[model samples]
Target chain A: MLRINDLHASTQGKNILKGINLEIKPGEVHAIMGPNGSGKSTLSQVLAGNDAYEVQSGTVTYKDQDLLELAADERALEGIFLAFQYPVEIPGFSNEKFLRTAVNAQRRHRGEAALDAFDFSAMAKDKMALMELDPDLMSRSLNVGFSGGEKKRNECFQMAMLEPSLAILDETDSGLDIDALRIVSQGVNALRREDRSVLLITHYQRLLDYIVPDYVHVLANGRIVRSGGKELAVELEKTGYGWLEDEAKSGEVAR
Target chain B: MKTATPDKSLTYRDVFASGQAEEKSWARYAAKRESALAAVLDRGLETRGLEEWVHGKAAGLVAGDALPVRGEVAAAGSPEMARVAGSHLLVFVNGVFDPARSEIGTLPAGASVQPLSAGDEAADLGSVARDVESSFTALNSLFWRDGLQLILADGVVLEQPVELWFVNDLAGEAGLIPVRNLIQVGAGSEATIIERFVLGQAAVVEQPLTEVVCAAGSVVNHIKLVGGEAAGEHFGSTHVVQRADSTYRSWEIVTGGHLARRELHLDLTESGAKCDLNALYMGAGKQRFDLRTRVNHDAAECETRELYKGILDGEARGVFDGLILVARDSQQTSAHQTNRNLLLSDDAVANSIPRLEIYADDVKCSHGSTTGQLEDEALFYLRTRGFSPEEARTYLAWAFASEVIESIPVLELRAELSAVVTRTLDVVDDTLMGELS
Candidate 1:
């Protein structure tokens, strides 16, 4: 459902993602792992159509449409969801309101009627239950004063609410504890379907133990140096990215 | 014959001469009026060295000699008027108490709300908002014919808010109008007072003055909702005094007036008194919104918190000057003042000044002010959530105002003020894409 051909992108005139190529068919869960400054997050941001990153030379085809040509909001309406690393703390906007608007926007994009408040609240209640989030948290400001675990859960709750066709989670497991990791993984695993795709971007192999991916791709210096099964994450977890760095610098596994 | 653009100070002198009724029975305070009139005419139409007139220019208003004491106009209100409460509207038309439009019902067991001209309490009218303090109050005292007087007997709790609607309209005439209000909440009494400025008038200058005195242990909530298509200048002031253990919470939501400047003063004279003063203002087009707060902590163990936020777009300007003074003997006093502004346009100007004076050896006082534009990260966050760029900007602006309006405990009033803030944002047909509708 997604194909990237030599995705070269940069931000603020500094090149980040360079000479990257990847493909993910429907229902495939792909994990992108890399060291610091390896362009893992940049790859996800570029895929989500973030304007901060300029696509110098790349063609990202999503379900046969030019993904890079769409605006950020248009990409979102087209069922592309990017769970940010740091969700903004909007002071006065409640979570319920924001999520409801998003859900309605998605429905409108699908040529469906908007849900009334009652129906929306009912849907939100079920999602909150599944995410193990407090019902009252929806009434509070979006991510304002929320704990790290709650924030991740809220992002998952939002993902569940929107049911995006392609979900790219950028470092969703960074600040979560073991319990929160399992819960967030469960929330993600529940959304896995034959028609939906997931891209898990992380820095560690611990998250892979919970939500096992169909394939693992290690990005090094903006290019995928290795791609294998889920066992590659466990192997990298034990050996670390040290061996890959040598191969990356030596131009050996640069494919 | 109307000097709509008089150029000199002596022009208002002629206005004062023809406006006052020196021999009337309610004119017992003619001596005070005479002195105030002198102060106004001497300071008249001159803003050269006035310390408080930083971005506020009243010389044009004074030079116009526009203080003709609101004459009778037809009581037809515009469709923009959104009354927050279903309670009685003590309508003050053209700055005078309009008995015809005011629909006051039976009060609590021992409460009374009437015109300032109807009772013997006129003797103590200027006790809180003294006429000698400022030229604006002096001018209001000089021209205010009738005002509101709300008195709650000791221990009486009036749940229904008393809404004083200052409904003023001058059609196309530039006129400086004044209205006054005196509220006395007795000891242990609780009340809520909402002052609504329903606008849809042009060339209207409103100078509303309010004085509130909360007795010992009393609780009072004051909400000032200023909005709706108003033009010209508006200079309003509210002075409050709190007794021991009394609590005063005020929320000023200013969304109208071409040049609106409001000053709120808090005198915590008794120990253990607590006061919360919050304000939210929005300006679009060429509108200028100025809000000032002065808090004097005169007693020990008193607390004060002042917060004001402003949103400016187009070439609008926002000014916030807050001053907190802790008396020498008022030890253990805690006070904090904060002012924040969001400028939507590059040409929009925001001036924030915070002053703190601590004479006491042991006191906690802090002040902070910040002026900034919308954060690109925040905008991007919303846009990524499926809102268009314009919708995201408008939604963020509207959310900035939500913090102030959500504090109103009265549901209907909160909803009404929220709608007014949306109106001030100039939402598309005021529907906000049916989100807030």
Candidate 2:
């Protein structure tokens, strides 16, 4: 469903993602694990079309179309959803209202009619129930005064609401309690479809135990040096990325 | 008193003289009006050098040639007039109270509504809103032909709000209309007063003065709505005095005008008194909106809260000046003031000044002001959700001002104001798009 060819991106003349390549087929769940400052978040941001990051040289194809050519919002309308690492707190805007606007925007892009308030509320209530979020939280300002776990659950709820074909979970497991992680994983697992793809970005292997991935890629020093199955995550957790860094350095010297 | 400019003062003097000749029974009040006018003429129209007039240019607004008095126009109600449910409506045409149009229904015992020109009543008429300080207030007191007097005796709790509707249909003539309202709420009484203005497409000047006295333990909610079309100018002042253990809340919403200036002065006199002042103003085209507010905490344990928001589009200019004062004996006084503005166009201007004066050492007082364009992150967040750029901007601007608009006590009024705000955003969006094209 997605292909990255020699993805080379940087910000302010500093290269972050250097010569990275990956591919994911339909219905596949890919997990990218790395240590701190390993360019895990930068890869997600670059994919989501953040203007702060400059694409030095790369080609990202989504469903056979050049994804980098689209604007951030246009990419969203094209069913590319990025669950932000830090959900923005929009003061004075109700979560329900923001969700409805977003849902209707995608619907309009797909040539569908806008849902009325009653219909939208009914749908939102069901999604909130699935995410185990209090119905009252939807009436409050978007992410304002929300707990960290609540913000993560809200991101999951948005992913459920938008129902994007390609969902990028950017540290969605960060700052979440065990119960919230379970709820978020259950929501994501329920949303899995044959024509959909998921990209999981995390620093720990704990989230993989809930929503297990089909393939695991270890990103180190702006490049993916290791690719394995779900068991590789458990092995990496037992050992560490330190050995992989030494191996990559020696392999580069031999090349 | 000596005048700096004789010709500038004579213009107002001649207008006051003609107004006095029409109403002979106002002999006792006329002396007070003459002195107030003389004071204004001596000061020569609040210059920009004054602290209060620093952001607002009051000279050009006051120096216009006095228009001839046109006959009374019809009281044709427009769609923009806000109609409250179960309200006692009092209609005024061209600043004169219309008895036929007014509905002075069966009021509760101890509650009365009468024209100020009907009888001699010591109802604190010119006590709260002194003429010496404001030229507009002085001009209103001098030339006002008839004014409304609302009285609520002690322990009277009114369930229905009293609606004061002023409609100005000048029909292309340049004229001046002075309106005065004196409201006195007795101790332990509760009442809501709504004043709405509807100005037609004409070059007109309206000077409206409202004085409110909240007795001990009473609650008063005052709402003012101004809607102007074309080149109408409005100079409005609301002076409120709160006694011990009383509460006063005010909401001012201005949507349209060529030049609109509103002054709000609230004095918390006795202990345990509380006051809340909230306002939302929007300006488009060459419209200019100015709001000046002062809250004085006189006794111990008094509290004051204020939030003012402005949205400026086109080449509109908005000014917000808020001052909170804590007297020496007013310990434990809690006062907070915030002013926020949203500028849509590059040429649009917003000036905010929030000041605090605390003579008491033990007091909690804070003031803040922010003026900037819409947040890029917020706009992007909204856009990513599927809204167009225009839709995103409109939603954010509406949300920015909704914080103050939602403070209205009446749900119906709040909904009405929300609808008005939405329509206003649509217009602003269209105008901005037009400018871009």
lDDT of each: 0.82, 0.82
**TM-score per candidate, chains pooled:** 0.94, 0.90
**DockQ of model 1, rounded to 2 decimals:** 0.70
Stretches of candidate 1 off by over 4 Å are B1-18, B22-28, B38-46, B70-81, B199-202, B361-365, B429-432
TM-score of chain A of 2: 0.97
Docking class of 2: acceptable
Question: What's the DockQ for every one of the candidates?
Answer: 0.70, 0.44
Worst 10 residues of 1 chain A by lDDT: A246-255
Q: Where in model 2 is the C-alpha error above 4 Å?
A: A12-14, A235-255, B1-11, B24-28, B64-82, B118-120, B171-173, B427-437
Docking quality category of candidate 1 according to DockQ thresholds: medium
Candidate 1 lDDT over B1-437, as tens digits, reads 12243233545556666555442422645776787788776666555677777656663356555655434543555334455555656877666666767777768888888877675545556788876667777777777666678888899998788888776665666566677788999999999888888554567777888899999999999999787674757778899999999999999988787878888988999999999988998888898888988899999999998889999889998899888999899999999998989898899999898999999999888999888988888888887778888778878887788877778878887677667677667777332447764
True contacts kept of each: 0.58, 0.41
**lDDT per residue, candidate 1, A1-255, as tens digits?**
899998899999999887899999999999999898899999988887778899999799999999988998998898888888898888778888888888887888799999989999988898899989999998898899899999999999999999989999999999899999999999999999999999999999999999999999998888899999999999999888888877788876545
Q: What is the lDDT of residue B357 in candidate 1?
A: 90
